[model samples]
Target: MRHIHDAPAGLIDFLFTELLLSLKDQGYSEFSLGSVPLAGLEARRGARFSARLGAYIYHHSTQFYNFEGLRSFKEKFDPEWRSVYVAVPPGANIVAVVADVVRLIGGGGRDRVGGKASR
Candidate 1:
């Protein structure tokens, strides 16, 4: 049962709150919404160049990526933030791969994730 005042929050936030509550009622000790794309990307000393770029994207790419907005939405659930690391093999073109991904997602291709190709 949800009360009107129980959610002064927005639609997405309200839905996630209810979903989490439902999971807790169903004996779920943990729930994961996976990693929010660019959360916790602050510029700090001794950080990787990729980390700095992520911080830039997170701060500046609002039109393309809703980094802080998603982060804020997830923060409503008080989730425990964790650092995730990725390793690349020697001499891999990580930058190019990421650029391709961004281009793909930003509708720069005839081959989007679930989009069909021209016949």
Candidate 2:
């Protein structure tokens, strides 16, 4: 059973709100929607050089990636955004590590877990 309101919140939104409320009641302080890589970068005064470059790429590279859509979906939950970065060890093969991670995440040409790609 659910209460009907003048403006009905969609099921996904309603469930998300309930989840957040439950987490709060259980004393959880934060909810994290993991990064949409290279999304939501913005240039601001005193921002780092890498961040400025990333922002430029995000704004300009829509054809190459779906940065806007990724950001929009995450924004629906009213979550705060923060920059995340990875550090590599000296002499490590970054490309290999990335490929391994992609494979592990089932992003390498197929979904290993469900056997279907998620839209």
Instruction: State which candidate has the highest lDDT.
Output: 1
Poorly placed runs, candidate 1 (over 4 Å): 1-9, 44-46, 97-119
TM-score of each: 0.64, 0.45
Mind giving the per-residue lDDT tens digits that candidate 2 earns over 1-119?
A: 22367656576567778998999999999998666665655798898655576677657766755556667767988777787666657665544543343344334545445343333
C-alpha lDDT of residue 40 in model 1: 73
What stretches of model 2 exceed 4 Å from their correct place?
A: 1-9, 41-66, 88-119
On a 0 to 1 TM-score scale, where does candidate 1 land against the true structure?
Answer: 0.64
| Model 2 lDDT, full chain set | 0.62
- lDDT, candidate 1, 70-106, per-residue tens: 6777677888888765565666565654455455444
Sliding window of 10 residues with minimal summed lDDT for model 1: 110-119
- Scanning candidate 2 in windows of ten residues, the lowest lDDT window is 97-106
